[model samples]
Target: MTGEPILEVRDLCVDYGLGDRAVRAITDASLTLHRGEVLGLAGESGSGKSTLAYALTRLLRAPGVITGGEVRFHGRDGSLDLLAADAAALRRVRWNQISVVFQSAMHALDPVARIDAQLTDALRAHRSGLTAEQRTGRAVELLRLVGIDADRLRSYPHELSGGMRQRVMIAMALALDPEIVVMDEPTTALDVVTQREILTELMRLKDELGFAVVFITHDLSLLVELADTIAIMYAGRLVERGPARELFEGPRHPYTVGLLDSFPALHGERVRMEGIPGSPPALTALPTGCSFHPRCPFALERCAVDFPPTATPAGGSAVRLAACWLHEGGRELPAPLARSLGSTL
Candidate 1:
């Protein structure tokens, strides 16, 4: 295994249109994921969590274009630039070097094709050296690995339950033994029971395989259990990043604090979870200075007019840094922010 990161995304930006009024779906978002680590990108809708994941896959749809960034993949074949990968290179790299478990696994599969064919497509595309017999054996092994019956591989997608179909998607993702896997709301469409069960299975697989994971979800609590590091995004920008414990234990940014509040814990008193005021701002017309200031309860004049420089300790990285005014002046986060972050959990 390379000592370098399995996936390194730097200064990545994705935009729509060609001019000043164009919307920036993601802006200067950067993160590094090492093998066996899970980096959770958490936020509300429009936080650009899903957009960034799709960007790494080079699967950006129309009205979504990558404006800047380098997605570097370090793998057995060698390091490759995802942003610059051509059709052939992308084919070789995708599924083979890295794979994505899309949110809607049932939808991601071909409705017209049998499950076996879907899994075989990836195996054939990446591991074509395998004979028909070899591919069939491997396909069944994969189905069993994801906890699905091997016979289900011959069935059509419509024949399986939602959770079973999701398992098949994961099985297909693992077909080539990719070093990194990106999961976008992996259990969104399932019931709570199924979601928990699926997550349990995913965690087990994660520990056993040692592959890195970029887990994109709106649920902060879920991330706490799954992620090694967590980055919170707001209005297309990363507001804060840190080890999961540090970020949850002491969230510096008001937005981060609000997110924690929004999800009241089952164990805690029924404190009112105040949702952040107003919807996310239009990307084409972003608020000046701090993008989160307009909705921030702790916002000050400087916060609205001047962007906060990143603050850090002498050694750095003890707590992942953030561009928030609250962290300045060697002060602790405000009482409300602290209470919001800690009242539960």
Candidate 2:
């Protein structure tokens, strides 16, 4: 069950360079993550999902900067503007308040360090008052919590299996007991069976630990099962967002419908799948109006000239929002689009 809002991101924008040459990576993205809610950010590669995650945590590298907007973290003490926070303040908040489980465990973990040393490093940095023995005990307990045995504490990253290394990364993220955990494709590169196991363990741990999650992936089918709320992105902007089931069953945006059709149905009878036409537009020279109009099968005349405003689509849930001309002025969606969605709108 989700509680009050814990993190609020408003009109966030990110750019890759300075001045006129800069390419906008994220534009006016906004979303709220409630305490203990699973918020999934889904889009294809280069859709800015990872960029958004990195920006939220103030982990963006040089040349990639937050040009506008606010990211507020509401903690037990008080609310904090993460973008405006100083380096010292960010350090204090990073591991203790919000931690990240990066995409690749091999790249994330120190190759030379033992699992125990890697796990205890955060405790040493953040919980300095703890003695060395106490930190070691916490490391062992964290490993056990992730289903790893204490015997593996002395093993290096190369010594562990792919699944085990990923578990170790998760254990480190939970070591500080953060209020929020940002997982950027945490299950990537693993086999199908291992992916399911990791996802199951993650959900179970979330229930036990009570931390909100920001799960980033390109897999909409996966998000429908794992996320409470799903936000769809295209070319850097959020195109649609709603309850996961609603968004999957009755998507209001053409891009979303296209994505759903691209994936095979896991349970239903086998059917022909169609991929979205054309590639995403370059961020430097985005088309006028809706960025997705070039590939939208149901694009309107206005879609070519005027950007669609974000609005609640007709026949959609009150909490759902989509940015498309078809949904403007409470107009019913076109017949072909409605047929594609397999729902009345």
Best by lDDT: 2
TM-scores of the candidates in the order shown: 0.93, 0.96
**Backbone clash count, each prediction separately:** 0, 0
**lDDT tens digits, residues 1-345, model 2?**
799999999999999999988999999999999999999999888899999999989999989989999999998768999999999999999989999999999899999989999999999999999999999999999999999999999999999999999999999999999999999999999999999999999999999999999999998888988999999999999999998888887888899888888888667577877779999998988999999999988888899898877888877778889999897665677664454334522
lDDT of 1 by residue, 123-163 (tens): 78777699999999999999889898887878998999999
For model 1, where is the 10-residue window of minimal lDDT? 336-345
**lDDT of residue 81 for candidate 2:** 98
C-alpha lDDT (0 to 100) for residue 32 of candidate 2: 96
Q: Any runs in candidate 1 off by more than 4 Å, and if so which?
A: 1-4, 313-319, 336-344
Give the residue spans of candidate 2 off by over 4 A.
335-345
Worst 10 residues of 2 by lDDT: 336-345
- Model 1 residue 211 lDDT score: 78
